[model samples]
Target: MELLSAVPFVGGALGAIVPFLVVLGIVVFVHEYGHYIVGRWCGIDAEVFSVGFGPKLVGWTDRRGTHWQIAALPLGGYVRFVGDMDPASAGKADDGDLTPEQRKHAFHNARLWRRAATVAAGPMFNFILSFVIFAALALAVGRASNAPVIGELRPELAGQVDLRPGDRILAVAGQPVETFGEIIAAFVRANGAEVEVEVERDGEKLAVPVSYRLASRIDYVNPGMPASRAGLVAGDVIVAIDGQPVASFYDLQLVTAAKPAGQEIVIDVTRDGELMTFRFMPDMVERPHPVTGETQPLPTIGIRAIGLGGIDPTLEPRGLGEALESGFAQTTRIVTGTINYVGDLIFANADPGQLGGPIRIAQISGEKAEEGLMSFVYLIAIISTSIGLLNLFPIPVLDGGHLMFYAAEALRGRPVGNAAIRVGTMIGLSLVLLLMVFATYNDLARL
Candidate 1:
């Protein structure tokens, strides 16, 4: 307590919480503003525009009879349009008894398309905010040059490969290449196999094989298994296999599977900061495919990679064209990757314990902010995209679910029955509460 007082502003837990508050404030402000503005444009009168909930700290009634206020809590905001049942937009069963003037301005009485537009605006604004942020970020930092010139060649591996600085990469595995992204794509597409790359140096073009996979760590070795018998220990990093670069566990699987079982393969690994090469013959084993659920014979050295460790994303500025291209590409990649991860969890292929609540978000927010502005902005863009995507899920109470209801209205030429809405709302609220409870548990467990 004394230390926190001495630090004054942004001290201790307050400091950590600041980043989360700022991020949430920005997202909430944008989302609520979308609702407010679009509702106004659609001729729906908003009764209140409040930042936060609970007791009001400061407030003013506008000339239009709208109460604009900053409430006690700083967590989230809401736009309470006229005729709402409380501020949740839930309709009352007796709303039809309102005066004609009130009914004319009621959101429930608005045209179907207008209501849909107002409801969808929140997530749409989130996506727009993310796209703009990403585009601006591109202009702030210059991007790495696409020319095949080598910069810093990592030690140990550099000496083994016949490549040098100032060498321009011409092609990889017979495919033409021009950028580092392309080079990485080639490596991933080849799995973990070595590829011959053509290079040009001082007017002389030469061909050199290079393996550029990120290091993989062996987390487990089956007892008395091939890997264990060969004296490979857990925590050993397998940077290369059979002189070929090893990128990921999947890469390790692909390369080893391509080889006939019982064939001796040289494995290069690093343990305790020391490099060691070991000889081992992989055993043929049947592993179930993720998609087909069928077991296929694949060679394995009886080792599995834990996961990637300590990856730092690098950002560079680029030409207007390139930057714009990268901006869209990165956003799309994040969206697709998030969908895949969520899908995996739904299918029980992923661990539910990985889910996190607001507590974890605050921790991550502080950590990313410490990494610097670019990284923090990147984090914001990612979270914004995620929030937008999450709200679009067809869970009953979400924006997507509301849109689903609107679709039904369009099909049936009538609003969803009040009884159905009441039941769905109950179910929706339950699911949301369950999600929060589950995620909070995960966060506490992690802590």
Candidate 2:
């Protein structure tokens, strides 16, 4: 009976493994199958369609003679074309002298355009997967909770500007504002210009004049800090610090940092169309150096300053076209943000702790999946989008690399030489190995 009871626990554990593996396998299979299908369509012979990598664990051969196999590693899969020297090769030529019939089926014998099509299909499938998933999610879930609208305005600023909570901004400085993001971006870019602000409030459109004020100081509180304990959040613009007028977040930070620890400070904030005040004492936090056994004192206020702005809620939900466009726009923003964040870390401008690897992704996937089906679907969409974007990067072993080679071939009227291919392959292989090592190290460090 005890052994029977344990079966449920064992089954549950096995069930957990199945979903992760299944999802990963499906994604990789779709990517590789893209190449296989396109290659066959172009009349090029594909020798193998294998899932995962490393040593083969299971195998089967189809009537067409394509060897299908499941490998030990579950990371990714690939399709091997006949006459291809290596995965990265453009299949410039078949080194072994073969019969005329065999030569016709060789990858190198295929027209340049066909070969390019085969290589490009992998990333193309990834993008198609992303778009379809996004469209389906949007159609099923409807739009995300409508973009935040102007909830409240600071009394000091309110007196100067006639805008109120629930006012929908139509445009700023003559630029059309379709979403809340556009409105805030326009406001910041205007930077105190005598800009014309058009808004819709209570079904009435109103035009108002507003100027941007140069930000002086910005205060960012660490998460779980005393400020958060006092109900302070990231977007709360501190209009007053310690009952003193503050121009920017910096001014608030400077004053709070200069104040003695445990001194109670009053902070005034405009949030979601309401004015609120909070009293809190800054806690002294210690930062210890890893190399040196030394510590530094820093103010602890748990919260990060993203930006200060009121969102206009009067904007209506977008149509299908607009929603799809917004999805693409969001994807672009995510890619740019990721690159910029990575650049920041490389230059020591940002914390390295933010970097994560496969383990982190898996943990996030599990957590998000546990939240609900919608959350899990959203995670899949994001991963698909990221995979698409990453494959588009101009790395030699990636799909983009093949496209690069094709472009060169088109320009030069011939394929790149074997020597060039060999060098590029070596460089690409080295880069991939190095990145995997770095990612694994980062993952382990977090653990």
The lDDT leader among the candidates is 1
Off by over 4 Å in 1: 1-12, 92-100, 148-317
Model 2, 182-251: lDDT tens digits are: 5655665565567999988899888999875535322333322345334454446667876888775445
lDDT of each: 0.67, 0.61
Kindly report which residue pairs in candidate 1 clash with one another.
141-317, 142-316, 142-317, 143-316, 143-317
The positional error of residue 205 in candidate 2, measured at the CA in angstroms, is 28
Taking all chains together, the TM-score of candidate 2 against the true structure is 0.56
Give the per-residue lDDT digits (tens) of candidate 1, residues 1-447. 000000011223865688887777677777778888898899988888887777999999989878998877775677877777656554443566667877888888889988889888887787877887887788886654655566444454445557675677789899998765565456556654689989888999998876554447776554224565455656788878889987676567667767875467788988889988876555555764322335797766667642111111133457788767767876776677557557756776544554556666666567667757876777677777777777777666677777887898899988887667667767876787688777766556534
- Lowest summed lDDT across 10 adjacent residues in model 2 is found at 1-10
- Compute the lDDT of residue 405 as modeled in candidate 2: 77
Question: Which stretches of model 2 miss by more than 4 angstroms?
Answer: 1-20, 88-99, 144-323, 339-353
- Per-model TM against the reference: 0.63, 0.56
